[model samples]
Target chain A: MVRFEDISTPARLAEPGEGIGRDELSLATRNHGLPLEALRYDLTPPGLHYVLTHYDIPYAEDGDWELTLGGHVERPLRLDMDELRSYAAVTTRVTMECAGNGRALLSPRPVSQPWLVEAVGTADWTGVPLRALLAEAGVRDGAVDAVFTGADHGIERGVEQDYQRALPIETATGDAPEILVAYAMNGAPLPPQHGRPLRLVVPGWYGMAHVKWLRDITVAAESFTGFQQATAYRLRQEPDEPGEPVARIAPRALMVPPGFPDFMSRARVVRPGDHTLEGRAWSGHAPVTAVDVSTDDGHTWNPAALEASDDHRWAWRRWHFTWTAAIGTRVLCARATDAEGRTQPLEQPWNRGGFANNLVQRVPVHCTGL
Target chain B: MVRFEDISTPARLAEPGEGIGRDELSLATRNHGLPLEALRYDLTPPGLHYVLTHYDIPYAEDGDWELTLGGHVERPLRLDMDELRSYAAVTTRVTMECAGNGRALLSPRPVSQPWLVEAVGTADWTGVPLRALLAEAGVRDGAVDAVFTGADHGIERGVEQDYQRALPIETATGDAPEILVAYAMNGAPLPPQHGRPLRLVVPGWYGMAHVKWLRDITVAAESFTGFQQATAYRLRQEPDEPGEPVARIAPRALMVPPGFPDFMSRARVVRPGDHTLEGRAWSGHAPVTAVDVSTDDGHTWNPAALEASDDHRWAWRRWHFTWTAAIGTRVLCARATDAEGRTQPLEQPWNRGGFANNLVQRVPVHCTGL
Candidate 1:
């Protein structure tokens, strides 16, 4: 049994030369990433999309579930699934990415969910707008933040509580991004792993802000400082430093490996010929404006054609390039630049939590006879 | 670039005290196991079901796909999706477990997919029977085996080829244990991760026998030797020995951890009181007859109530046990017995490939105040 003090110790990076442990492997087996090749689909199939669950997927029956809107509200309300679904609904395509998407790639990696660039996926979510519900509840005077709590309860870093994260009052009541209380994914009811009855979908923010298995929303008069927000998803180099809270995703572009993979090594093998390279690029801050592909590592690059960004602005944009291959082994890389002029970096700054590290992706390929 | 000779090196057990490599971690991120808590549902959700893809999920268009049946068949034929769907279809709920489900738990674990139980799920698969398709093609006399090939192509152990596996002709054409040319899962068209257009589902066999993205069927007059059949999925202790091929899944039982889990260690914590333990048990060899639960780490055992097994005989059966908890740390274990009197072993013998290791499960729980 872990002692109480040991459980409360702050998160730390893996020791130098340390490898992924059994604990991290256990978490990896439970959570999955979008297979890099799945980028071919515009709206990733539900099962193929990435998933990251902090605790057990709470077993819930829709008929017995209820969402309570209380705490510093004009009028407290509790609504069942049917009542919640009665509101006017809208469907929107959004790309969601975990805050720790590239955690394992960091030097002296954070020993949590060991992700390596596959932690992003786009989907069409259907639900009632969360701002509509907040307007109906009437956020009382002096409300500073809104806390959304999921039914999934567990102990994290010694504190035992329901999983939760809070959004600033203006963001919660904002009209532009269109926050949603989603109940369906792609066209079907949310699967157990995606949270059954209801979940919060915060567009343009990291996945931590999009709480799943949502059961309660409390409008608070003070800034909400939950363990997830204050302790876990922070960008800090030292344990004692209070770092910036992670939010919007950084711009990143990932390609479908050009050729077949070696089953054990995953090294690509492509015959010498002409090939069409396609991929998806996205950013939570703004629409993507440009994508660049590199055949000789990052030494030289060529611009790729970007798709029109008028539709699905909050989702990924398709990009493509044509390449003529020669007989040799080479490294392929892709980088994206958003409308706000934020381009992916060749190297990402390291942090204790390893949140939002969008280092460029490099795929090794062998150009030889198949 | 990987040397050709290095690519041909056989898979070996991890060096003593060595950790999981980046290659294995990359594979784990792409594939996933069912979260143990999902055992509560009778029909596991599509997204929560465990998936293992040896190679990439081949891109397929149903309208463009055609299944060819030839080789030793007296009447070689090709059928498109519409024609294949016109035949009589049957839906069956089968519990499928990976042959390497408990691989990581073995000492000196094999350096492949590092699975630790949880690599099992039950789903309702719908499609036309393979025997019917075989009858339509009319197998010729002296046919010894049938080879099924998938569209996923890759290099494994220095051999570049489309993934292929073969089954004895008698088993492929058998009346009992019906095999399916499946095209749907859980009432929906096959998801890309599960195989897009078509797949093979062999009831009462480990998942290795179920080929995904199936495209071709060839009947042979001699026993077929393929890499997946003769090399990878064998139970041998020596590198050069050709051991028994892994076919049927051994009896096994896994319980949903009784209480909430620690986010990192996954150690269960429950308030000191009476608690009910629930789990699922299955065996591909025969129907599971009894399940025994032990709170003292297999030292003392108590019988659990088993649900009716007449329906969904090929699927898992639910079992439950009530335990009164005391404030302390305890180990929980569950073991299953099949109708053929085959019970799970307390410890599994080590093998080079780490296939078919179904020892009893041990869950560590802290029965203290939450």
Candidate 2:
């Protein structure tokens, strides 16, 4: 078992020496604390994984933190941290990733962070159900959306900036216990960098919706449009304009491309004999139903053993496969299929920034005597 | 004229005491910089406005930015910032608002920015024509989505993060100069916070499509997804599930609601006397053909003067009306009708995280001695 000391925090400070431009870190290429060669099973070894958040890291504050739920509701509420924790606690092992994972791999390598693959990670999260609070608040009819805000602030276009995003009411109060108002990560109180007091853990979706340092919950018939909603997280192009303002387009939610590959194409160092290949698979909208591995690119394929599905359907599943090959150079690949019948593709279509990269996993490896 | 120095830089830092909640800085409430009273105008002020982005602020380098056009074209090439800027430059004043503007005003205020009512803004933007770039780049048949990415970075959960979004091809290569690769804002170099080196500015739609710090431009047949596309800025609960996970729902682009009010309500803070009221009107799918104002809270109404339309068909138009009232208190309202005959409603349907809040505008004013 890997010890906690072996877990290296992937967070890096934006320093001058760190070349700007595409050199910045991105979801697709940030190096986690684990070897890219090792393919683990079940839980993502804390070292080799991805992280997600909605707002900037909250400051360390011990002040009284309260969550208020009001507006159009039968009964308004103000729940403190302790009060919220006292309620039934639920734990879920889910896979959470940034919406833009795998972006760096896009051909032409979009201008954002030149992520060298590995933009996702899975963790067992623990939190309270948001629905219970809504039930306690007695939701009223016409409650359209729920707005979540965080404590971090910055300067955007020289204006005071605070991050905010909204979720539909149905999702906020759904039967699935996956939507969590979380306080813990990987079985520990969230660190200051990861929304200490409170944050949201929304499985199957990108990290943006899981707001950090969550402070207020308001039920409304209308949607909210703070900086994050109206301007920051939006598309700006015209529906028929055909490449006028490349960015100006209608805002749509992030999606895991239907044909995206589920597992990472990786190789493990092995002796010149028999060996097994392993990896993991997950989806944003559905559960990982199966994983397939390819030994010769797409020329041939074989089924891999998949771990049991986790409590959170949005989380990813671990898988492994054994194969014998002549010691030499080989191309390895993996693919995933979700419950919705979506499967990984051989290659992803090229986009400007490489948003949803679900292309088949391909890794080239050279064999040496072990 | 508002002098540059006297104008306060059109930006401000967030106050320390500001609460940490989505609604605290939402456009809906007066406290969030977007005052409800400002909605009386048809054209949103430049200072009080909305902006969108795909990546974090890019490091503003020299004229290092370039525009590339290739794929199924006669010639594939790259145009640096100077080369692209050498082409003809055009300027237009337009109103750009999030599709979910006024979302917070909904009954339950869906789960988005708790906008208290101010998610709209107008700006005088200058940029190069997209047609020129396409002509220089060359077009292809199978091209479907034009993806955009930025240089911003953050940590979500425990991982590094980057922002990205995409738009359809038709919107990328449109006829009108509505789409712009903007380097200047309000006739000056765009501040770093607003897409410094370069950005896409498509007027008349939600903000997500306008990718900031744009880097790459790809022509493809399929849409990409990271977190932003598949999860964050989507509309679920269309059929209205009260408490479902947001991921289970399919994402739909922002749509103009049916039966919306034609004109925004107007009010004059003056002694009991005759005064003229004015505001703006427009639609997402169609232009605003006319607007009508009501002083009796919808009981009676009068037609307002409509301004000539602009090149940006999706832009809102200014309208005004004169009315007489007795001393005391009065409620004013307005509604708008789009070219397609869709009218604003007295109240918009509630969704989770209040999106698409286009209800009729109602203003309450107190009258004094004549």
Candidate 3:
């Protein structure tokens, strides 16, 4: 007997205190979440699709924001939006999710936003390759890390500071020209809500790696440890557990399971009969090679028809399963395995911050007798 | 040093299997998820907001869809959308979250939708009260529960069935008029994506209690043991643990801490200085009575001023605290207490399915030397 009231504490919204009013509270909620309804595709979700900015949106005036490349470089250089735009531009569809995308889903709720699955969205980012910008600065030897800084700064917790993060020198130059100092998204100038003027788009990495409102690039001999680097975005096992900073996304499969309304949290009313269950899959480490759909509660698994993706290393693929649903309750589960055989598990390894929770997704459905 | 590879399996999007081509994959991804930037908020996130339907959306013809009230009642009544609309209409604001809103946040993530915190949203639903309609149906004695049946159905896990949930006869009648068979949302007919024509909104309860595209109301002599009622949505300890079904929201306080976009996930660059921090707090058990602010990682706490709310039992209150910040890294934390003397814990008891994950939210900030 699962008593409904046994849930103990059934608080609804984190109600507003006297500090804010209904209107203000409304604004705050909107400011933080990219609605689930915005979800469209499984691949290339769309640039303006979803974003997780660390600070309030900063508006830049013409010639105001500048990207200054300094540190252990032979020729330190500073470039504005227009100047950076003059360089060769490349466009790529990248999937970006917040490092804390599942923070709220954690049992104890990690110290981050209470993000739902909606924290993810895909976008086509156009920008100057980071390697090119670094190359123009003539990087000197002994630089171990490339530190990226954003213009949005504020008091987080209690410390007043600027936002900064870092990537290893190898990663900065490896897929030369893939990491971007982007100025445009979806063929339009970067929206202020997104980092305008310039932002870093680390294809396949979590959103935090893509520093917004880019302003400085420091080629340092040591790793960078600013606000976001040293403390936030790290995947801890315990509260005090010193863990790795969250980065690239984990491979996972998401389908518009019959009744689910795209990315919205609301379930759709599914019907009894045969249905084409389909969705997109992607991976950062390796290409998605196989997808398995389980309609009988993982009892018997069947391989879903797969789609070959483009040559783009970061592009996603589509998969489908023809489900002859019966008149009853069902849990339609989808699982994917990358080329490296890194398959999604029934349960994701639990980390402190709930980062990259890419377990198999179980979508519940009910078919009417009618 | 947490290496980027430390994330172990850095897979990106759920890629398609080796079947379809890039073009087809593109079409599939676009088939779901709304574009992220399209999010708009009223009290609720909207029809496309945080809805989770059970079966394929059932289309009801103007003359076909009907609401039948029977079982244990004296005079069974049948009404169409038009007839139901003729009853006295009432409207109210309600914040609804999926019972599995924080599903993905769970450790060893549950076998369900990999939801983040965005699985919640508020809405103003207008409809005829359930009790009023029940009265017209004339409930007879010996009725212990009202089993609400939705037209949606399907196979869940392995069980074939329709979607049905029950409400104690008392609650159905006690919260008279508040529980409505809603037809209009934000002043429009319910969108098909959101249970077109008819749906139930049980205020203060999780989204599961709000049946959508409703069809039948059966007054029963005992509790219902449907799949969702006895099996799914329950908080189990071990995999085989018989857990209770999750219900009601818990007491929670969340502030739009600096660095996080005012209402967006985009990081807001905060400057070094003293700033007033505020946000909303609420509890389903009782009204929020007090809130405490902690700046030094929970070392000390200070009382925050609370705003008195009118007698809207389900509404939340806003609260605020002031802090003088220095240029450095910091953590901002807020804990809330309800009028029942139930204060939030620094650590909430961990539960399966990650239900009621209402621990305090900590926001990090960084102040530069500048």
The candidate that achieves the highest lDDT relative to the unseen native structure: 1
Please provide, for model 3 over A280-328, each residue's C-alpha lDDT reduced to its tens digit, 9 standing for 90 to 100. 6777777789999998777779999987676656766778889987766
Question: What is chain B's TM-score across the candidates, in the order shown?
Answer: 0.98, 0.74, 0.80
TM-score of 1: 0.98
Q: What tens digits encode model 2's per-residue C-alpha lDDT throughout A194-247? A: 576788888766666778788878788887766555544332232222221111
Compute the lDDT of residue A347 as modeled in candidate 2. 65
Worst 10 residues of 1 chain B by lDDT: B1-10
**Model 1: residues >4 Å from true position, as ranges?**
A6-9, B1-3, B6-8
lDDT per residue (tens digit) for residues A1-370 in model 1: 3464454345667888787888889999999999988999999987888899998999998999999998888988899999988999989999899999999999989989999989988999999898888989999999999999999998888888899999898999996689999999988889888888789998888899999999999999999888998888888989888899998989999999988877887778888899888899999898899999999998999999998865887899999999888888888999999989999888776898889888999987888764
Worst 10 residues of 2 chain A by lDDT: A257-266
What are the per-residue Cα lDDT tens digits for candidate 3 across B133-230? 88888888888999998876654544446778888888887774279999988787876656667988887787788888889999998887887787
> lDDT by residue for model 1 over B1-370, one digit each (tens)?
3465454355877888778888789889998999999999888888889999887888888999999999999899899999989999999998999888988888898988889889999999999999999999999999999999999988887888888989999999995689999999998889888877899999889998998888999999998789999888999989899899999888999999988888888778888889999999999888999999999999999999999866887899999999898888899999999999999888776898888888899998887764
Root-mean-square deviation of each candidate, in angstroms?
1.3, 23.7, 14.2
* iRMSD for every model: 1.9, 24.8, 18.1
* DockQ of candidate 2 relative to the true structure: 0.01
